[model samples]
Target: MHELAIAQSIVALAEQQAQNRHAAAIEEVELEIGVLAGVDVKALDFAMKSSVKGTLMENARIVRHDIAGEGRCGDCANVFPVNRLFENCPACGSYAVNILKGKELRMKSIVMATIGLQP
Candidate 1:
């Protein structure tokens, strides 16, 4: 699946970050994935497990933050929940709407080994 590639890219990014900091390994990783990001969580989890094999993040604890879909109506400035890309405004009944959230797929934070340094 495409999740494998996503997982591999995640691992590579984390590994590269750790290496740049001269870390011995990665301790934890935090990710933010929105509900409307179109990612299969189960598949991504499995792919991540496989992708981290023998890598710096092999022992890293992964933390995910799930964001709900939110949008704002352009016509009436009404804020509402949106599950689809194109949604009509609940208040004004207009199709003009801007998504405020729920389309994110990003790595939030990465905790790395101190490697003989005090923090």
Candidate 2:
């Protein structure tokens, strides 16, 4: 699954960040996942857990923020909630819709453990 690759990438990034800060370990990782991002959350979670083994983030807490999908009608300028891509506009029933949100898969923040610091 691509989730495994994604997880590995995330781990690498976290490790890089921790090393850059001279951290002893990673304490937490905050992620933002959008509904329309096409990533399976459960699978990604499992992949992340597996990927962190023996890594700096092995004991880190993983926090995920699920962002809801939203879109704006290109024809009528109406904003509405969307579940998937290429959705027809609810107000004008047009296929020309511009996505306003919910296409994100990014790391929002990371908490690292400094040397001799109790977290």
Please give the range of 10 consecutive residues that has the lowest summed lDDT in model 2: 110-119
Over 1-119, each residue of candidate 1 has an lDDT whose tens digit, in order, gives: 88898899999999999999999999999999898888888899999999999999999999999888999998889999998778799898999888899999999999998678766
- All candidates' lDDT scores? 0.93, 0.95
In model 2, what lDDT does residue 109 have? Answer: 100
Candidate 1 RMSD computed on C-alpha atoms after optimal superposition onto the true structure: 1.9
Q: Which ten contiguous residues of candidate 1 have the minimum total lDDT?
A: 110-119
TM-score of each: 0.91, 0.95
Candidates' RMSD to native: 1.9, 1.8
- In model 1, pairs of residues that clash are none
Cand. 2 Cα-lDDT: 0.95
